[model samples]
Target: MIDAPRSRYQQVADLIREAIQRGDYAPGSALPSQPTLAGKYGINQTSIGKAIALLRREGLVRVIKGKGAYVREIPPISRYAVTRYAEAVRESGTARGAFDAEMAQRGHESRTELVQWGETVAPQVASDALDLTAGAKVAIRKRHMHADDVPVQIATSYVPWELAKGTAIAEQDTGSGGTYSRLAEAGHTVERFTETIRSRMPTPEEADFLRLDEDQPVYDVLHTAWTAEGRAVEICVHVMPTTQWVLHYEWPAS
Candidate 1:
């Protein structure tokens, strides 16, 4: 049996992908206009649009409504599960959190914008993770994290109101080492962390905040910080774009 011919859009997509791989279209550079691509490929604008859409879904390019499509600039960031949470690094006083330390080590400028910080009723997830009552109050800290000035992740942390009340964790800055450090200072040292991760398409708000195209998906990570006595001290929700991150993990083979 012979293989059938590929569709026009598929062919166009392949050509464009090849050009991108060959560096003809540099990362963060705009691709040719639809009309130009159409004329150059002897294809209609509809096919060109479909081709670009296909590329967008493949994580090769991003489409801007008024500006047109551009090659995706952000490289995949490797998230080291274990070392990122090292107590020594947090106590070093040079970085605020794992995100800041990792970005600085990678030679990228890191920034955190405090979106919301205050006491609020615990959400179901937070309540369950922190073993709090359904209507229990909790201190909330929401931050938008950036690397190289590009939006990368959103982290929102929740702690039992009594634990965080009148503490630096309730403040916008959280001093050094971030929430974990403050928790340690408050006699709730985190001995270990549990993270549950899932992936889904970005919501309208998340897409807008992260500047993500419709085709991009995001990782929702529920992180629970626990103490040596097995009490949950903090619950944090981390949302990151899938195209911009690669989670890494390692453990002893004992």
Candidate 2:
């Protein structure tokens, strides 16, 4: 680590990271509170706050705003040279396809459980990403996706409700199916999706929901699906347990 300025917050973050990398804190362990770190380093609370924020952005720790920080665990890299699982599965002869077939042969049912569904206007971030009015009404769907009933990911999908409103696709009886398939049936072909990957420790609530331990960190994935004509449509964000899933994506030769 470089010798940094006396910027209190960054110093604290560096100390914590050094301790972690040196195995003093160890993975999956919780660090002492801001006050403790502040006192130990003879710094004030505000500096500790800054240090924690830096760590959060660096993906070394995750704080639930009101909750404390915990050490983050690194997810397993795929044996396949891909970036996302969904894309890998779709591409022919992709490593992801072979892996999925093998997993299916062993009888792993990729299932989805409906968690939430409703209509609401877009928040600023979703609106900007989907290019909708800041408060324009949209349809929101949330699902807990699983592999053979084991919780694999929690995804929240947002769509312009006016387009699919009153249709069977947004009805309560769509059952446990993927939103992409349902949207296609509704005449909205999903052409492309962009995803952003980030790392963080799971919140206590998320840990319980996903049946993960304190040691297993979560991967936060934010994605947007667009139509072939270049119109942004559905926006989805998923929090997945890194220990349970591997995401792969393959790019065709240029």
Candidate 3:
């Protein structure tokens, strides 16, 4: 039996993918118009649209309304789960958080923008994670993080009001070691952390804020810092574009 012939859109997608790999279209650069691509490939505009759509779904290209499709510039950054939270890593006297230190190690510029900070009613997830009653007020610290100037992650942390009020943890800038250090100073002393991760399509607001395509998915990470005495001190929700991160983990065999 003979193999079936690929569709025109598939052929076009292959060509575009090859061109992108060959650097014919540089990353972050827009592709030619649909008409131009159709003329070049001798196909209809509808086929061109389908080809671009295929590329978008494959995480190779992103289409913007009225702006055309552009190559994705940012590469995937590795998230080292085991070492990122090591005491020495954050307390190395650099005054940088785990994300910043990781970025610097890989030669990428990183920045964290404090979007909002203050006390607020705890969301259900936070309430449960931190063992707070529903509708209880908590201190919130929200931040938008960038890698090489590209928005990549959004993290919102919730702390019990009793622990955060009048503390640096509620402030815009936490001193060296960030919130964990501040928590330690305040007698919380984080002994370990737990994270639960899941992936889902981006919401409209997330897409707009992260400049993501409608079809791109995001990793939702729920992180909790716990104390030696079994108290949950902080709960943070981390959202990151699926295309821009690679999660890494390691543990002892024994």
Candidate 4:
């Protein structure tokens, strides 16, 4: 039997994508005009257009309105692992240090901008996660995490207002080791954490913040903390862009 021949558009797309991988078309640089590409490939402009579309869908290139197609410029995401919150790491005295340590390894700096805060009636999800119901209020603190000034993740933490009303967790800056530290000081002393993760296409608002294509999805993480007494202390909802993230984890097989 004979192998089927590849389509012209696919062939062109593969060539261009390979060129990108080989750095022939450096990231952040414009590609040759569609007409020029069509001429070089000896194919019609429509074929060239389809080839370019293939590259765009695969995230190898982005076409800004009137800006033409440019190779996408970005570094791979740092692998995020749950172990970063180990006691030894938290001893560094800044909860954010866990994030900084990971990003620093890749030469990327991290920052968090306070986005929303204040007491509010708990959302159904928050209410269920934190053991609150019947319209109980929550102390909601939210922030946008960025890597080198590019927004990467949005996190909103929910704690029962009764426990957080006069605590440092309610403040803009939860001094030193951050919220977890404050929770400990207040006797919550979280003994472990549980994270539930899911993936879905970005909401219109999420797409705008993450600068993602319509096809891109985001990771939704529900991270919760609990004490030895089995009382839930904090529940944080995190929205992370899927393209720019990698997760690492380890466990003893036995």
C-alpha lDDT of all candidate models, in order: 0.86, 0.66, 0.85, 0.80
The ten-residue window of minimal lDDT in model 2 covers 75-84
Clashes of each: 0, 7, 0, 0
Identify the leading candidate in terms of TM-score: 3
Please state every model's RMSD to the true fold in angstroms.
2.7, 8.9, 2.6, 2.9
The number of the candidate with the highest lDDT is: 1
Tens-place lDDT per residue, model 2, 122-214, is 766577878887689777767776565556667776777766577544654543334565667777788887888897888897888876656
**Candidate 4: tens digits of C-alpha lDDT, residues 130-157:** 8887699988888877887877788789
Comparison by TM-score, 3 against 4, better one? 3
Q: CA shift at 190, candidate 3, in angstroms? A: 1.3
Q: Give lDDT tens digits, candidate 1, residues 106-162.
A: 888989888888899999989999999899999998889888788889988899999
Q: How do all the candidates rank in terms of TM-score, highest first? A: 3, 1, 4, 2
- Residue 25, model 3: lDDT of 94
Per-candidate TM-scores read 0.87, 0.53, 0.89, 0.85
Better of 2 and 3 by lDDT: 3
- After TM-score superposition, the amount by which residue 152's alpha carbon in candidate 3 deviates from its true location, in angstroms, is 1.3
